[model samples]
Target: MTTEPAADPQAGKSWSVEVYRFDPERSVKGHLVSYRVPRLEKMTVLDALAYIQRYHDRSLAFRYACRLGMCGTCTVMVNDIPRWACRTSIERLGGETIRITPLRFLPVLKDVLVDYAPFFAKYRAAEAYFVPGEERAEIAPISPKSRERRAIDPNLECITCGACYASCTMLAHDAEYLGPAALNRAFTLIRDSRDGARAERLAAVGGEHGCWRCHSLFNCTEVCPKHLSPTRAITGLKRSIVLDRLRSRLR
Candidate 1:
């Protein structure tokens, strides 16, 4: 755990931050508000927001848990790029002016907090779960060197923080599109030997708005905090589906 230095009133430092402000009860609208905060070395954007909430304004609202970037709850658009606030250092911002906004492709709840219901709802719709077979009592061993297991190695690290979804242009145009994380999870199960839901899972994601919707932008791969590439998983799913279809035609 990294402990931030105590606020120094005598410190000759200041930063101008543009924060998106919204209160459901206060107004039917939202806008950006500027706040000047004392700067400290190694201070993060989350720390800046917390300082403003505690000192300058008590009404500011945002979502954050496990401030060390594990939970992925502090994700937001910093200068139009998706990043975890806890991991972004204020010194690396390159300027004294900071622009903050709610994540794109989601409903803004208040301030920088966006409603995640739709994101998680798509996860459920994609049936992103591991299904065990009836022969569970028999301990079936799968070699780590197997192609399927090796393929799913990177896809298994997803934290579902909605960063990729927020950065995705597919969701920006079509809300029904299953975002990368869900598709990645689906692909993982599709390749699992223990899963009995492959056919059903394929049916769920084989539509026009399913795995085919990915445009190969690689934006999900670019913004993932855990460095997991959902785009790769999605591509693997497409290959699996195409091979299966071709095999069926041959039969």
Candidate 2:
């Protein structure tokens, strides 16, 4: 975590970084701490945080991994918008001051770090995983052009970073709501020809606290790091439920 301050050659351009700070163990109330940092070309919010920690304040805490944007772990609220810190370039932001905070709808563990336990709990409640079918001597082959394959292709890119979960307004009001990430995972598995527990998966996500609760605000779609759309996936689940009910009634 230590780096020579001189290593950053572009330490001339100054910008203010306003960070949300709190610790339940040490502090009664959380507040924002400001630091003026040097900006470089292509400097990301993650870079700014690293600079702040390395130079201004070692006590500043945040979560980040694989600074290349492939890992969703570096997610933070930038000016009230949920975005991957690594992916957001400071140059793109036309402001001299940037507000950095932990994701919303989750308890803040510290500065820019939020508790994800509740988020994963919703995931499990939705049964967001593939259940393999009976074993066979040979592996099954699925065509790339198949409807199910095409339907789930984009969703397979989900990194489970909780960006969609954090950006979700639905989760803010309804804690029990199976968030976009979980429901999106459910939709992917439901559409997968390789998964055998489609009925059970559907039941999990179609319950009272599931896909039906989504208000279709599309916040999940806007904040997705991988550019995948959970709103579309949740809609797919809703359509499946309607078709299933219609089939049962007709029979």
Candidate 3:
């Protein structure tokens, strides 16, 4: 629950928004700062933050880009759920008060701005990169109907917004776990026909800190704005690992 800031108890056509504020240089614990805003038709949660910034407080900080649902940068916790602020309509949430906070499981640098370094660091740890073919004199022909391409089509939508990462309970417990995004990226690479580093990519996502750490909670899938399923991708990795082991045994 958020502590409502002291304001004039005047009732009007306005909504109360609680934004989490913190300054790593000044404050050790973040606190909820409330803002009274005029309710507008089709106003989004992002719109409310902007209104607060423009008319209420310019110092209020949050991230947004594309102003549309495409960029996942504007994600925040709306009523304890991770959502894209730009696309989340205040009316849709059905509350006179909204509690907005930085995405969970990440360090907050300031108001609604969390440090993404540790989140992106896992990408490197998982080696989430597309390694080109060793002897690629020409582009490898891949069909639109190819099984490899189809297997990875659903997972290619990740914007790496860390929504899934923030929603992941596993990360709160296992610091070394690669989490969903990196493992999903690895799964795509492993399924890509043109990727030459299949074995290396597989190794990167197969161990204790890799896809094995996923608990199948599907929280990653639930919070994904693009509707991509990292859980499915992680399961694919596990299946690949098992199949590879069976092949090795047979050989």
Per-residue CA lDDT of model 2 for 90-206, tens digit only, reads: 879878889998898888988889888988888789999778867768888778888868878877788778888889888768888999999998898888777898788888899
- Candidate 1, 50-127: lDDT as tens digits: 999999999788889899878888988998888899999988987878988999888999999999888888878888
Residue pairs clashing in model 3 are: none
Q: Where does candidate 2 stray beyond 4 Å?
A: 1-12
lDDT of 3 at 217: 92
Off-target runs (Cα >4 Å) in candidate 1 are: 1-12, 138-146
Clashes of 2: 0
Candidate 3 local lDDT, 1-251, one digit each (tens): 99988875645588989989887778789899898988888999999999999998888889998888877888899998899899889988887899999998877878998888888888888888888867778778778788877878889978878888888999888888998988889888888767788787788888788898898999999989889999999999999989988999999
- Least lDDT summed over 10 consecutive residues: which range in candidate 2? 3-12
Per-residue error (Å), model 1, residue 130: 1.3
Least accurate 10 contiguous residues by lDDT in model 1: 7-16
True-structure lDDT of candidate 2: 0.87
TM-score of each: 0.90, 0.91, 0.92
